[model samples]
Target: MSGGRHSWITFVSKVIPSLSLSLFGQVCGISGCFNILVGCGVPMRSINSFALIGMALSTFFTTLRSFSTATLQLKASKAFFLGFTNSIVSAPMVFFDSTTVGRIFTHAYIYIYVYITHLHTPTHTHIYMYIYTHTHICIHIYIYMYMYVCVYIYIYIYIYMYTYIYIYICMYVYY
Candidate 1:
């Protein structure tokens, strides 16, 4: 019963936020897919850019804040900054180049951490308590990322396809 209680507590405290973010991504992806199939202009590009910028800035500042506060000797701040910056810059490029299909899949990334953590168990010999301890923190890391990817992908695909069709139709009318 103690184990179950601990698991439930861990889940509520650690997994729920990540799951919620993942689920939000899933919904965004589905919305993108639907937009592609049936034209619905929803300011995907601007929203995406804003999301990217906001997420990058937040993560950057948060880490700097964490480093000064935490007593840990390890310096993971640089890597996190790089990753956060890279995601912000790269998401728009990838989605615009690929098919609208990519938008539908981007949200699945937020699930990676959660699902992976579930694969790990807290055992006496394994020392996975550390892993479980940081579980909730990971969600804060990826929330911006998942949304940025999906929105960028959706907007790019919609723009590319719609523009192409609009141009072709215009040419036919002119000719």
Candidate 2:
């Protein structure tokens, strides 16, 4: 009887919490990614773009956050190298695709919120400082790149529209 009770207690304390955490992460990842992708013109049909983007963003942010925090706490040099590598690798994806940039920002915001709520120690005080600096730098870079892309696309579309309008006006004048 005691053994059975102990097993139940273990399950409740360990397994249930793990399962709940996994479920929460999954829900946040899926929904957050879906909303961002949908807002960015990715269709909800034929491809699970929502889940894929969501999971990618979630995993990317979570791993990055965890790595950054751990490195900061440990005062590791590898963190800087990792950050540089990440920026280089992710720059193209973000620059070419506005949707990916949106997803990344959204995921980062959500991850920060979740991280803050789960905080538990005074020793973790500097964690936010690290997060803030890293996030600030990343946000600036992404924003500049995204804006550049948007402006280029907008210019292209505007030129096309202007050309069409000019042609139409010329045809009307000729007639």
Candidate 3:
């Protein structure tokens, strides 16, 4: 189908590049850190700036890949569903007259679900497995964010308690 072909074109144009960039970023991040750790002249003196840059790039590219795949999946599903619906709607009255409403509805639903589910299954599996396996690569970022929030909360609570104690002491001494 033209829609399927178009979806593949979109996937190749968007997803493949995103996946490659994400892998490149990951390599960049790892190599930068390794270079710094091994005390390479340039990296040791430069404060390993590449590590941070690579991390940012990796995060961005990974997120892009995820979003692009999701978008592609939705677009393909919509295209297929719409095409099927259009054909059903534009069919001759004779075609519908012989088909019961329940049968038509059942066939429509089954076809949409079955076709979409079965389409490019191996490709979907590879994409999903990649996503699942690599998901943990971003855990450090999440951990850092969680630690930041925790620190903020701790500071707020400490300040609040200190202020409360200060007020209590002032009232006690002044009274």
Each model's lDDT comes to 0.43, 0.50, 0.49
| Candidate 3 per-residue C-alpha lDDT over 60-168 given as tens digits, one digit per residue, 9 for 90 to 100 | 4434443444456545545764676688788888997889655775655555444434546532554433333333343223223333433443444356445544643
Clashes of 1: 0
Candidates in order, TM-scores: namely 0.25, 0.25, 0.40
Candidate 2: tens digits of C-alpha lDDT, residues 1-175: 3768899999999999878855754554454343354346554454444554554454454444334334444343235435744775667654756556456656655565466556666534544444444444554444344334334434443464455446434533543
Indicate which candidate wins on TM-score: 3
Stretches off by above 4 angstroms in model 3 are 1-48, 111-123, 126-175
The local lDDT score (0 to 100) that residue 127 gets in candidate 1 is 21
Q: Taking the candidates one at a time, how many backbone clashes does each contain? A: 0, 0, 0
Say which prediction, candidate 1 or candidate 2, comes out ahead on lDDT.
2
**Candidate 3 Cα deviation (angstroms), residue 159:** 32
- Clashing residue pairs in candidate 2 are none
Error of 3 at 44 (Å): 14
> On a 0 to 1 TM-score scale, where does candidate 2 land against the true structure?
0.25
Clash pairs detected, candidate 3:
none
The reply for model 1, stretches above 4 Å from the true place, is: 1-3, 38-175
Best-fitting candidate, scored by lDDT: 2
